[model samples]
Target: MLEHLDRMEAHLRELLEKEGGWLPFERFMHEALYAPGLGYYTAGSRKLATPTDSAGSSDFITAPELSPWFGATLSTPVADVLRDTNSLDVLEVGAGTGALAASLLPALAELGLPVNYYILEVSADLRERQQQTLAAWEPQVRWLDRLPERFRGCVLGNELLDAMPVRLFCWSQELEVLERGVVWHDHGWTWHDVPADSALSRIVRERMPPLPGYLSEVNLQAEGWMHGLGDWLEAGAALLIDYGFPQHEYYHPQRHRGTLMCHFRHQASDDPLKLVGLQDITAHIDFTAMADAAHASGLEVLGYTSQAAFLLDAGLLEHLQSLRESDAHAYVLQLNSVQKLIQESEMGELFKVLAVGREAAVPRGFRRDRLHSL
Candidate 1:
């Protein structure tokens, strides 16, 4: 582990020197998380697990890891898209541990709709782990290194947009915009502010409030990803689940400090400079920006809602009742997990679901959606 860290640090130092001792935060973040063999996601590390799993073995746990019902309930909306489009294909981006695919495929089959599942994963290490976990469905599943030129299926991405690189910016007392980047100083990485370029400054001035000393991030990469969706997503829906808020709430006056976070061994921190490539670094998504990008790309914003509302509207209670009749013990266990998933104080409210597609029906999970809020 120490040797790997040394190599990763050296690689980062080389990147800094190449950029004249300063690197844009987005560039640094991209390399820190996706650099060919030295980045966090590119390295061979156990990244996902349930909280009950052996401590310190994984960096963090996602909603699918907390309960199989997450994927089971999600199958309803996915099936809707498949039936509406008359397609038998499902594409999942960043399929961690293949847990969602494993749980979702069986549920979809139970609903009398078996589809081809494709995973577009960039991490070679994660692809190997997903293959091992999904071996049982070998014939039905395939992996791809990049997005296809054209596709007709339901696209799913859980916690995907948040991991994309974001440019950090701050406002000065005079309301001047500045780009916050990284610099090598004192034999370590540190923060350095520079006059925001014309493009970045224009974006900040238009989207962000004129509050002095406010710090936040803008995810142009994620927006670009959304814009590209229309080119390949010929006739289907893309369901993105992540933690974020609308533009108004995202750049609200009170949210002075940005939504940047890091995780290691299930512990959360605000520091991304520490641990180099050994920890996970992420920021919150801007759903409104995503919706705007979808519109610009000629795709419709089908729906938007909290995870809790989406789950309930999609028949979570019915599934729970069925489980209760079959096994009382398992029912009790899952009830606890459901509370964590839907409660206002937990993942339920923080996490949101956004659906964008071309010629796709509004998913059943968005019956009570809050699209107007966006």
Candidate 2:
């Protein structure tokens, strides 16, 4: 990992020098996470270990990685789309370790829905790992380098959008917007601020109320990605699960420092400058913006709600009931994990699920949605 970081840092140094000692934080983030084989996801690290698993350690565990029940619960909505739309294919983006695919495929198979499972993973290393994870179901599963021309069925991504590169900016009482970038100082990296682009500057001035020294992130990349997905999606729905807030709450005056976060070995911090390519860098998604992108590109928002609501509506508790065994201790452990996934104080409130689709009805899990909030 250190060697990878060193290589990334050196590569960044050369790029920084060439760009006149200035590089947008987004570019640095993009390189750190997607720069061929040296980036975090593409480098083939064990980044997704179960929270309770004793066999391995990881930088973090996404909801899908934490429990099979998560994927099993999600299968309800996916299967709903597959059946309703009469589509035979499901596309999963950025499938880490293929844990969700492994859990979901079998659940679908149990219902005798043998749909073609296609993965659109950019990380070559993680792609290989996903193939290995789903080796048992090889005949039914396949990988795609790009979106199959005019894809149908369901599309899903767990904790995927937040990883997209974000543009950082700081605003002040004077209404001055300073775009944040990377600069090599006396020894290492530090922030370099300049006049923000006028369009974003207007957005900050009008949308975000004054909060002196307030720093925040704008996920234009996520919006653009959604636009592309919306264009490529001929039919069906896309469900994105992650930790985020609506636009109002996202740029709230109280959130001065923004939702940008960095994760390393299960510990969280605000310093994306230090870890280079060894840590996971992300920012909370702005569902309103994402939904807007989808809508502008011609898609309807099927639903938007907290993870707890979505899971409950999708029958998580009922699934848990079925998992009960004679062993009381094991059952209790499963209950505890489920609590972490749904309890308000745990991931339940922190994580949110957004559903968007074209030519698809309201999703089963979105029976009582809060789309109005987004």
Candidate number of the best lDDT: 1
Writing each residue's lDDT as its tens digit, candidate 2 over 1-374 gives 67877888898999998998899999999988888777778777767776665643688888777778898898889988888689978999989889999889988887788989999898888888888889999998999988676888999999889989999999755768988999999878999988898987886776677676999988888899888888788889999999999989999878888988888888889999987888889999999999999999999888999999999999997777776745566667777677788889989988999999998887778766888997
Predicted candidate 1 versus true structure: per-residue lDDT over 1-374, tens digit per residue: 88987888899898888899889999989988999988889988788886478998999888888899999999999999998899999999998888889889899989998789999888898899899988999999999889999999899999989989899999988889999999888878899999899999999888976889899999999999999998899998999999999999999888899899999998999988888888899999989999999989999999999999999999889888999999999999888888888999999999999999998999889988889988
Residue 233 C-alpha lDDT in model 2: 86
Which whole-number lDDT from 0 to 100 does residue 175 have in model 2? Answer: 61
Worst 10 residues of 1 by lDDT: 43-52
Q: Pull out the clashing pairs in model 1.
A: none
After TM-score superposition, the amount by which residue 29's alpha carbon in candidate 2 deviates from its true location, in angstroms, is 0.7
Candidate 2 regions exceeding 4 Å error are 51-56, 325-330
| Model 1 alpha-carbon miss at residue 56, Å | 2.2
Prediction 1 global C-alpha lDDT: 0.91
